[model samples]
Every structure is written in C-alpha cells, then in structure tokens.
Target: MALWALVSAVGLAVDDRVLVGAPIWAKPFKFFVSFAAYGLTLAWMLAQTTWGRRTGWWAGNVVVLTSLVEMVIITGQVIRGKRSHFNAETPFDASLYTVMGLTIVVLWAATLVIAALLLRTRLADRATAWAIRGGVLIALVGAGLGFLMAQPTAEQRAAGNLDTADVIGAHSVGVPDGGPAMALTGWSTTGGDLRIPHFVGMHALQLIPLFLIALVLLAPRIARLGDARVRLRLIRVATAGYAGLVALTTWQALRGQPLVHPDAPTLMAAGVLLPAVAAGVWAALRTAPEPESVRTKTEPASDSKEFTA
Candidate 1:
C-alpha cells in the first residue's frame, strides 16, 4: 500500500507535456502500482468488515482510507518530482493517472454511503436534510463513474453481449469526443472523463442509487393520500429509470453502436441512457409525493476535505 501511494504521488506530479507521451525516465510509472494499492486497500476493507458492523458505512471508511492513501501518494510525488504532476494522461496506462481509476470508484461509493447516512438523522432542519441528500447524490454520481471505469475494456466487452459499448474497436480505446454531460450537481472531473467505462460506471452508480433510494428514504414520510401500496409502486416506477440507465450503459459498453459517424457513437450513448433517465425522472417529478414536514436549520457538516480539487 505504501509503495502504491508513493508511485501515484510521484506519477501525477509529472509535467503534462511529459504525460502526453513523454520520454522515458522523466515519465511516471503507469498507475498499475496504484491500482494494485487500491485493490489491496479494498481487500483490507473487506477483511476489517466482520459482518457485525458492516453497514454501507464500511464503504465510507474505505473511501476515506483510499483518499488518505492517495494524499500520501500525491504528497510524496509533489515534494520531489521535476514538475507538478497533473492528471492529464501519462506515457504508461497507469502512469497516465496519479491514482488509479478503481480507487476513485471505491472512494466515490464511500462518499455516497456517508452522505446517505447523514440524511437519516432528524437533523431538526430541512437544509441539513437537503444538504445530506445533495451530498449523497454527488457521491453517488462519483461512484457511478468509478463503476463504469471498473468495467473490462472494449476487448473484454466483446467477449459477451453485456449490452454496453464495446471498447474493442479502434475508437473504443478512449472517451468519446462529445459525450453527454453527467455530474451530480456540478461539472466535476468524475463526471467529465466519459471516455473510460470506469468513469461512466462510477457516475451512473452515484446517480442511479440516489434516485432509486429516494423511494425508500422519502416515500413513507412524505407520501400522502392514495393507498400505501400505490405510492410504493409509484416510487419504484420512478426509481426504475435509474436502474434502466445502468442497464443501458452496461449494454452499449459491451456492444458497439449501430450508427457510424464521428459523433454518432456519442449520440447513440445519450440516446440509450439519457432519454430513459429523463423519462423516468420526469415521471417521478410528475408523480412524486409532496413532503408533509418542514425542515429546520442546522450546521451543514462538510466532509473531511480529504484532497484538493
């Protein structure tokens, strides 16, 4: 773990000019070591989870742990590298990244879980509740991107009809030039790197869960009038949109699109996931039960500023 962190720290600090395929020696170690570190970190997290207290919070701990580990990695790199390492691509696959994509995924999920946990509190205020929800939603989107990138490359996608965009082709190797805008509430990089499956998966995981879980969290408390069963059904119907989006991303990644053009692939991707998500969200908005209670004001706790943007 220490070694992984060290390498990531050193690698991300390299100059961008060097990263866009720089000469040897000056280039950073491909993030393979970081990936290894993340994998080990995850393994450690699972090992620590004894089932007695294995709430989604473990995900949060793992996320924080991952961040700290990354901080250590980046810190070390920053102190000594020739240039300040930027996240822009590097020579080697892993080298191109400061922290590997998988770590980002775990970190994102952890954040989501933490935010969701926060929302459970009575809080004595509405802003706090909204803030918690917003936090969770953002974290969820980040996690979704991580999940998407975790997927096997296009080569792996071709193995079966998983119903996702196949990365096997010449173009499948990287992010589309023009992809749909995907972020929780703002344009964080977690939402911007639409090229890799991991990024897409991470963002999607973040989004789908928030909408899906909304039914469970907000439904009973705010639901009014109609049969309990009817409201519950509506909630499910509303959340179904997110589930469908997950499915669509998985599909297209595994399979190449039918159309052929520069932006065709990007368009097809949007067509598959966004339209469905839009419909589902529209339906939810139209039918979602109005809240009966008013929220109070409270200090909106900020998560540990684990790393700088």
Candidate 2:
C-alpha cells in the first residue's frame, strides 16, 4: 500500500500532459491510491475473522489479483493515451473494457462471500462484528453503483458520440465527460458526480472499523456509564447513520446536485435527517441496560479469538 501511494504521488507529479479530457496520468494515480486503501482495509477485515480462514485467504487473493488487473489496465490505457472507462473506440479498447468490467464483477462476488463469512462468524466484540458486517454490505451497495455508470445516459445517446455504444456510461450526470473537476479527486464540481457516493461507500470498510476501535479503546470509560448495552447500541446507531449518509449522497447525486453546491431542498432534507439520526442514537443510549460493571467485579472472557494483522 505504501509503495502504491508513492507511485500515485509520482504519477500526480508528472501528469501535466492532457489526454482524453483529463491529465494522462490522472486515472492511474487515482486507481493507485484507491487500490492501496482497499487492500489495507480488506486485509484488516480478513484478519479479524476466526471462521472461514481458508475462504478468507482465497478471497483475499482474488481481491488482490483482480485489483492489480484493474489498475494495470487503467494505467496501461492512460499510457497509451486512451480513455480507460467508457472507451470502445477500437476493437482493442473494447476488449480491454470488457475485461475490466468482468474483473470488477468477480471482485464484487468475492466481497459478497467475505461479507457472508463475517456474518456467520462470532467475534469477541459484537460491536466489531456488526461493524464489519455492516461495512461490507454498505460497501457492496457502493460497488453496485458502478453499474449506473456503466450504462449510457440519455444525453450520451443523444449526442451520437462514437464511443457511446462501446463505452459504458460516465461518472458525471449533468455535465459532459472530462469537464472541469475538483482539484485532487477530479470529481465534477459543476454537476452531480456518481463517484461521490461510490467513493464514500467504498471507505465504509475502513471508517466503520475505525469507529469500532475507538469505542473499544473507550470501553473502560463507557462501562462506567452504567450501561453494558451502550456499546452495541452505539454501533447500531452509527451503522444506521452511515448507511443513511450513503443513501442521501446517492440521492443527491441522482438529482443532479453537485456535492459542494447542494440546493435548498437538499439542505432541508439533511436538516430533517440529521436530527432524526441524533434522536435515534440518543434513544438507543437512554434505553440501554445498566452497566455490568456496576453489579459485577469483572467481565467474562470472550469466546472469540483476537484479531491479528
């Protein structure tokens, strides 16, 4: 992952030349960074599982191999001065695009299997288990968003673009491909970009697990609050809020609203949702049972094994 990050940095530094609507090295740099993050998160999650170690091992291999294939193809295309996604300009490009699509489908399937394994296994910490399960499921939804980008939009069809038939759809909803974008991310600032929710969803695996870790570190303090169930309830509340945020962002993007320039209705929706989510969390905490520490000298040993990296 560190090596990929360094490579991404190098790609960014030398991406002054433009190709196919953006910097020639932009796609490769983004893929490198994204793959690094995904690899680290996936590895951590697999390490936490006790059951299906063999399945997890195989699944991890699949993920790594497929991810490499994706990055190689994307980077190779950029080096060739061609669009990686939605490019069917030639027989070769179309074949490469097909292979990339199929590769992602396999990756998604492997992720589902990992999610199932996580669901069936019992972890030492229920909150951590819930975090992994919820994170994978939410991440799958984010992965599925790729399908939306894979289909040609009405606008694309109307434009009679040459690559319209061979290429999948695009990332930007209200703007043409390769338009003005945000600095580092290159997500469209002038219109809705499906990549926003997609990116957020992908990182749930990392974010939710980190949240679980924070809760675990604070377990001693939390136990003093007179509620053993507080930790579990907090996890549930956070999962709900996280899922809601993903849905909200997807909705916002579908409505052609840019992430940075949300309109009145979007703001109003968020206003209502924020309080509702807070109320849910408060209710969960308020109704939790008294802390076990208040009645007992020590907590019982957990049956599950500790997660190792």
Candidate 3:
C-alpha cells in the first residue's frame, strides 16, 4: 500500500491530466496513503487483542483483501482516466463503481468485526485500552459516513439524470464536484464537502492512539500525567472530545456549510465543546492521586530510611 502511494506520488508529479478539478492521480494517492495507515493500524490491533485473536486475525485479513480490491478498482480507473466513484457514464464504469462500493462495504464490515473483538479484549493499561477501543468505535462511525456520499445528489435526481448521469453522487453538497477545491486534498472550498467529515472520522484509529502515545511520552515531564488514573481520565476526555469533533464536522457538512466558513451555530457548538473538554481535563488532573514519585518523596523520613535498608 505504501509503495502504491509512492507510485501515485510520482504520477501526481508527472501526470498533467486533471479530473474533477484536481490531478487524476490525487484520489488514488490519498486512498493509498490512507490504506497504508489503516492496514498497519489494524495489524497492530489484531496483535493487541487476546481473547478473540483468531476471529480478529481473520477479520483483519478480510479488511486487507477488501481494501486491496477497492484500491485496484481505483487505480485502474485512474489509468483509464475515468472517475472511480459516482461515475456511471458507461455500463462498464457503472459496474466497476458498483464493485468498488461492494468491496468498501465488505471492508467496513470486517473493520466492525475487528472492533467488536477489540472491545472484548482486556489490557492492563487503561489509557491504551480506551485509546484502541474508542479509536476503533469512532473510526467505524467515520467510515460509515462515506455512505452519505453514495446517494445521488439532489441536482441529479431533480434533473431525472440518476441512471443516465455521468456522475451519480457527489462529495460536495451545495456545489458540484470538480469546482474550486483546496489544494492537494481537493476538498471543496466554496461549499460543504462530505469528504471533510469522512476523512476526519476515518482516521480516528490513528489520531487517537497517537494522542495517547503523546500523553505517555509527556508523563515523565508532567507529574499528574504519570498517574495511571489521571492518564485514563485524560484519555477518556480526549476520546470524547474527538468524537464530538467528528459529530460537529459531520453536522457542519450536512448543513451545506464549508468547514472554514462555519456559521454562528457551528461556532457556538465549538465554543461549548472547547470549554467542556477543558473542564474535563481540569477535573481529571484535580481529582488524580499524587504521582508515585511525589508520594515516595513525601514519605516520612523514618519510612524512607527503613526502605533504604
């Protein structure tokens, strides 16, 4: 997957062909990069799971297989200079898109199986455990968001062009695809893009665990963070905050609001989320027991001397 991403990167540089207002290779490149991270993350998850190891392992393989099928279709479409998604210009294109859709659904189901198994497994590190569990659960929801884009756009439906349309669905809500978009990512800048929420939601498995790892790395420098309970509370807070972010973004996109142009309601929602998360963190720290080092250092002199003996 990573090698494919590198190949796509080269294609991006050399191929001047533009599709949907972006380089033809851009979508394949992004998908390949995402698949590389996703595959590695699932591998790690299977290794960490104990009770349902066999089930998880098989499910992980299913995920890999389905993902490969999806990618093959995508890369193949790029080679043909045809749109991989929502393209129904020809019978072959429609069939390929349908196959891609089926493979992605299978991939999603396999991920759900792995997530269920991960939920059942026990780990000693509460923070790490929650990170994995929360990440997978949120990622499941995030992955599911892609389905929102599968429906034909209102414009297509209103035009009675559902079956005959060259494009069926669209990532953009208020605007059409291939319009003004952000650089590299190609996300719509003029209107709500469902891809924004989908991207944010789908990567929680990577982002959440990375957040936990950052906390662990900071533990030595931050005394309260060294406490297991404190760390666990913080992780819980972070997971919830991340979930809220996904929800907010999803809501924003669905309402035809571009991410960068959130209206008052969006700002108000964010305002509430920010302070709630801050308060949660503050409470976590305040309620935490003293760190091991602090407790040991504050121990009575006599006890300390006896321990030295």
Candidate 4:
C-alpha cells in the first residue's frame, strides 16, 4: 500500500513543472521502499539480544508518534486539498515550514532508535540477518534523497547570485494554479534522481518486512497453536488481507481508468500503486519458499551451546 501510494504520487507529479526536473521512476521507487526498510529493522531488532523489551517499547512509541505526525500532514492534505511544500514550489507559512523540519527530525529519531534496537535482535540465520542489514544500509540512501526532494529546481542550479530581473520570484505549477511561485523554505533539490531513490527507501519498511512476516507466520507450524486448524485459518486470512490490500489498489486503478476523463490524479492515486504491489505479491507467492529457520519453543533459539563449539 505504501509503495502504491508513492508510485501514484510519482505518476501524478511526473508532468508537473515542479517535479519535471525530478527523475520520476526513481523517486517513487525510493520513497515506496522506506516502509519495508523500517519493517526489516524492527524485525531484526526483535531478534536481537542487545536491546531489552523497554527499548523495543520506546522505539515503537517514537515510531508510532512520528508516523502520526506524517499521517497528520497526509491526512490534512486529503481533507484540506493541500500539497506538501516539499513537493511543490509553494510559499509556506513560516511556522508550518518549521513543522516540516520537526517532522523529519522526529522521524529520524524514530529511525535511530529503531536501529539501536535492531542491532540487539539478531536473526537466526546468517542470510536472513544479512538481508536485514542490507535493508538498514539502503535506508540511509533513502534518507538522503528525502532531503533532496525538498529542494528548488530551476534557479538553484544556476551560478551567480546575480539579482536577476526576476526578483519578483513569481511562477506557479499549472492550470489549477497548483504550486506556489517560490520554493518552500527548508527544501533542497540537489540530487538529480533523488525521488526515485526516496521511493525505494521509504516503502522498504512495509514491503520487505511484511514479506518476511508472511513467511514466518505461515510456515509449517514451528509452534503449538492450541488448535492447529484455527491457527492456519487465521494465517490464511491474514495473508488474504495483505493480498487483498494489493488487489484493492488494483481495483482503485481500474475504477479510475488511468485517471482519464476526470483528470484527478490525486484521486486516482488511491487505486494504482498498491494494487500493482498486490499483484506482485500474489504472483510471487506461488513460488514462495517456506521461511527457512524454525526453533521449537521448547528449545530456546538462543542456547549458549549453539554459540559454543
């Protein structure tokens, strides 16, 4: 779903003057992957012994809180018809601009906290552990691109602060009078294909980890579920829910019909990317392998003997 949201957002932004300089394909992919990265981080932390439960709880709290802040802005946009200043060349009220910075700061705090916890929980298998580690590394790249997305495009690249005949600092996105004439205050548009990378980074939190979870949750019973049938049924339902979400995105796209006549890409966004992902997951599942490692609860996974000769 998160990846889908990002892809649709990219599609919407593609032709817009504000994002024209952005590498469309790359940006959305970057942003979409951040979620999966985060998920893997948390999962790895859950496996680690370095952090205590309290650390996990704290990290979870911060993540939840910062996510709420992001949700607020995204929700507000949904309700109030606003564009993120970072994405648009809009003049923001100074205070709101500050809030955007604050939002990133909090999110960073969450990531750092999660990273600490992740270092504590080591996955059982070397390969799985390595994959999660790779996730963390990629996440940093996503973070950098995020900073870039908030930058100005045209005039910034030019040399000389020559007070152009353009002191008026005036110009907007398009027919709907989309973005503001001037760039948002805290943004920086440095990297050329930053958005693509950003999309890749952000969605990692959800996509990759959920992919892992689906594996762990469904494997041929590593534990004693009171009713095996019931547990399997629940797992099936959960998988369906996740897959259904992807399907839902598809439905949204079909309903929007490629956002044709109505010309409401923002509205159409609800339909596209998520379903595409859903379709991917569904297709992938047919060939999906069982989650590799399973330690019976009766024998704790972390035995001093396993670490010994």
Candidate 5:
C-alpha cells in the first residue's frame, strides 16, 4: 500500500489538470494512500484475532478484489478525462459509477463481518480487543455516511442540468461540486463538506489502535499500572471521545460551515468535550493498580498471558 501511494504521488506530480482545475490524478492518489493505510491496519488487527484460516483467506480475497475494482474504475476515469464519482456524462460513465458503488458495498460488508468476528473472539489482550472493536464500529459509521453522499441534493435536481443517467450524488454540499478547497485535503472552505467526517471516521482503525500503542510506549508506567480490564475502560473512554469528535465534525459540516470557520456553538462544544476527555483519561490512569512487574513472580499466569497477547 505504501508503495502504491508513492506511485500515485508520482502520478499526481505529472498528471494534467481536469475539469475541476485540480490534478486529474489527485483523487486516485488520495484513495491509494488512504486505502494503503486502511488495508494494512485491518490486516494487522485481523492477525490478532482467532479467525480460522479459510475465513481469513476469504476475507482477504474480498478486500483485495473490491479495492482493485474500485481503484481501477477511478483511475480509468481519470485517464479518460472524466469524473470517477457522481459522473453520468454518458452511459459508460454511469455504469462505472454504479459498479464502483456496488464494490464499496461489498467492501463494507466484509468489514462488518470482520468486526463481528473480532467482537465474538476472545482476544488475550483486553485493551487491544476494545481498540479493534471500537475502531471497526466507528469506521462502519463512517462508511455508512457514504450513503448520505449518494443521494443527490435538492440543488442538483433543481439545476435541471443533470441527465437521467446521473443517479449518483456528490461529496460537497451548499456549493457546486469542485469549488474552492483547502491546500492538501481539498475540503471546501466555502461550503459544508461531508468528506471531512468521512475521512476522519474511516481512519479510526489506524488512529485508535496506534494511539493505544503510543500510550503504552510513552507512558509505560501508567499502562503497566492497569490490568487489562482497567486498560479496556481507558480505551472505551478514549474511543467515546473520538466518536464524539467525528459526530461534531459531521454536525459542523451539515451546517454549511467549513472546518476552518467554527461558530460559537462549535467552540463551546469543544470547550466542554476537551476537559471531559482529559478528566476521563486522568481518572482512568490514576485509579489503576500498581504495576504487576512489582508483584511476586509466582503471581497468576493470567497477567503474563495478557501482556504477551
């Protein structure tokens, strides 16, 4: 995935501009990089679970096939000098869009199956288990938001410019597609953009688990002070806070407001949430029992198992 992302970056550097004025390869590049991170993270989490060999292989095949199909159509459209998404300029373009959407549905279903498997399995590390479950559930909500993006806005229909084949919708709201955007993210600075939440929520699989791992490494004393159960609580609190941030960003975007221009209510909400999250983290860490390493070596085998897992 990292290699693919690097290749896409090279493509972006040389690709010509499209109708929207951005590099034609920008979308593909972004997807390549994003999916690389996403795929690698999911693979790591699955390895930690007790999925049977056959089930794992089936799931892996589904992920690879769907991702390749989606990327091929998207990159193919770019090369054809047409939009990959929300494009119905012709029957062929429409068909491509429909196929891409269906592929995503298959990918999402596979993800849900993996999530369920993780939840049902008895992971040896409670914190890691909680992280995987929370990340998958949050990421599913992110994927579900794509449905909202699939329905055309009233403005699009009112324009009377769309064709019968233009069944797919768009990512931008309160503004026409391909308007002004931020530097790298391309998130609109002038209108509400669903892509913000979609991106943040989709990457939770990487962010949550990585964050927990960082906590253990950087704050070893605190992490080791807690039993797996205590660490699980800490993870749950952090995940709740992360979910809240996703929701807040979605709400902010729905208001036709750019992320760079938060209103008073948005600020107030953040003010409240920030301290609450900090307090939760502090309490979770402070209340944990002393580190097991300080206990006798004759202690129960469960602690050793938890650490190893």
Candidate 6:
C-alpha cells in the first residue's frame, strides 16, 4: 500500500488527465493511504485482544484482503482514465462498482466483528482500552456514511438519469462532482461534501489512540493526569467529544453546508459542545484524588529509600 501511495504520488505529478475536476490519481492515492492506516490499526487492535484472539485475527485479515481488492479496482480504473465510484457508463464499469460496494460491505462487517471481540477482552489501561473500543465503534459509523453517497440525488431522480446517466451518484450534494473543489481533497466548496464527515469519522481509530498518548506524555507536567482514574475520565470526555464532532460534521454535510462555511446553526452547535467538553475535563481534574505517584514524589528521603529498598 505504501508503494502504491508513492506510485500514485508520481502519477499525480505527471498525469495530465483530469477527472471530475481533480487529478485522476487523487482518489486512488487517498484510498491507498487510508487503507494502510486502517489495516495497521486493525492489526494492532487484534494484538491487544485476549479472548477471541483468533476471531480478531481472521477479521483483520479480511480487512486486509478486501482493502487490497478495493484499491486494485480503484487504481485500475484510474489507469483506464475513468472514474472509480458511481461510474455506470458501461456494463463493465457498473459491474466493477458493484464489486467495490460488495467488498466494502464485507470489510465493514469484518471490522464490526473485530470491535465486538475487543469489547469482550479487558486491557490493563482503562484509557487505552476505551480508546481502542470507542475509536473502532465511531469508525464503523464513519465507514457506513459512505453509503450516503451511493444513493442518487433528488436531481438525478427528477432528471430521469438513473438509467441513462454516466454516473448514478455523487460525493457532493448541492453541486455537481466536477465543480469548484477544495485543493488536494477535491471536496466541493459550494455545497455539502459527504467526504468531509466520512474522512473525519473514519479516522477516529487513529485520533483517539493518539489523544491518549498525548495525555500520557503530558501527565508528568500536569499532576491530575498522574491518577489513572482521572486520565480515564478525561479519555471518556474526549471520546464523547470526538463522537459529537462526528455527529456535527455529518449533520452539517446532510444539511448541504460546506465545512469551511458553516452557518449560524453549525456554529451554535459547536458553541454548545465546546463548553460541555471543557466542563467535563475540568470536573475530572478538580475532583481527582492526589495520585500515589505524586505522594511518592513528595515522600521523605528515608521513606523513599525504604520504599525503593
């Protein structure tokens, strides 16, 4: 996958063809990078499972296999100078799209199985445990959001293009696919782009774990974080906040609002969520009992030496 990303990067630089108003290699490049992260994260999560280890392993392999198949089809279509998703201009294109859909469905189910197995297993660190669990849970929802782009828009339906149109669905809601888009990402700037929420939601698996790691790195400098219980509470708060972010982004996209141009309602929703999350973190810190590590640090020299001895 990493090699594919490098190849795609070269293609992006050299390929002169444009499809849907973006570099033809762009989608394949992004997919290669995303699947790499997805596969690695799932493999690591499987290792953390105690019970149902075999099931998790199998599920992880399924993800790897399906991801490979999906990337192959996408890259193949790119080589042919054709659009990958929602392309039904010909019978072959339609069949390939259908296969891609089926593979993703299988991939999603495999991830769900892995998530269930992880939920059953207990980890030593509470923050790390929930980080894996919550990340996978929210990632599933994010992956599921891709289906929203599969359905034909109301315009397509009203225009009677379901049978005759070259493309049956779109990533953009109010704007056509080959319109003004954000650089690099190709997300529609004038309308809601489902890809925004989908990308953000799907990456929770990486984001949440990184959050815990960040908190741990800061623990020595922030006394309250020395308490495992306090860290766990903070993790819970962060996970909730992350979930809310996913929901908010999804809602914004569905309402046909561009991410950068969020209106009053979107801003208001964020306003409410920000303070709640801050309050949760503050309460967790304020209520935490002084950690044993802090007590040890403050102990008399003789007591510390005796404890070490």
Candidate 2: global Cα-lDDT? 0.81
* lDDT per residue (tens digit) for residues 164-240 in model 2: 46555789887876887888788888888899899888888888888877877876777532343676777788888
Question: Which residue pairs collide, candidate 3?
Answer: none
How does model 6 fare in lDDT? Answer: 0.90
Query: Cα lDDT of all candidates, in order?
Result: 0.42, 0.81, 0.90, 0.44, 0.81, 0.90
**How much does candidate 4 score in TM-score?**
0.44
Q: Is candidate 1 or candidate 4 better by TM-score?
A: 4
Instruction: Report residue 206 deviation for candidate 2 (angstroms).
Output: 0.7
Give the Å shift of residue 265 in candidate 5: 2.3
Q: lDDT tens digits, residues 1-309, model 6?
A: 989999999999999898888888988999999988988888888899999877877888899899999999999999999988999999999999999999999999999999999899899998899999999999999999999999998788889958778898889888788888888788888889999889999999999998888889998998777788888898899999999999999999888888889999999999999999999998888765653554335546665567674
lDDT of 3 at 69: 93
Q: Give the worst 10-residue stretch by lDDT in candidate 2.
A: 300-309
Where is model 2 more than 4 Å wrong at Cα?
Answer: 160-167, 219-228, 287-309
Ranking by lDDT: 3, 6, 5, 2, 4, 1
What's the alpha carbon RMSD for model 2? 7.7
TM-score of each: 0.36, 0.87, 0.93, 0.44, 0.88, 0.93
Point out the higher-scoring one by TM-score: 1 or 2.
Answer: 2
- Of the pair 3 and 4, which is ahead by lDDT? 3
| Model 1 Cα shift for residue 149 (angstroms) | 6.6
lDDT of 1 by residue, 199-278 (tens): 33334323433443554566456544233343344444434444454444444443543122224656676676667656
* lDDT computed for candidate 1: 0.42
Q: What order do candidates take by TM-score, descending?
A: 3, 6, 5, 2, 4, 1
Point out the worst 10-residue segment of candidate 3 by lDDT. Answer: 290-299
How many Å off is the CA of 268 in candidate 3? 0.9
Q: After superposition, how far is residue 87 of candidate 4 from its true place, in Å?
A: 7.6
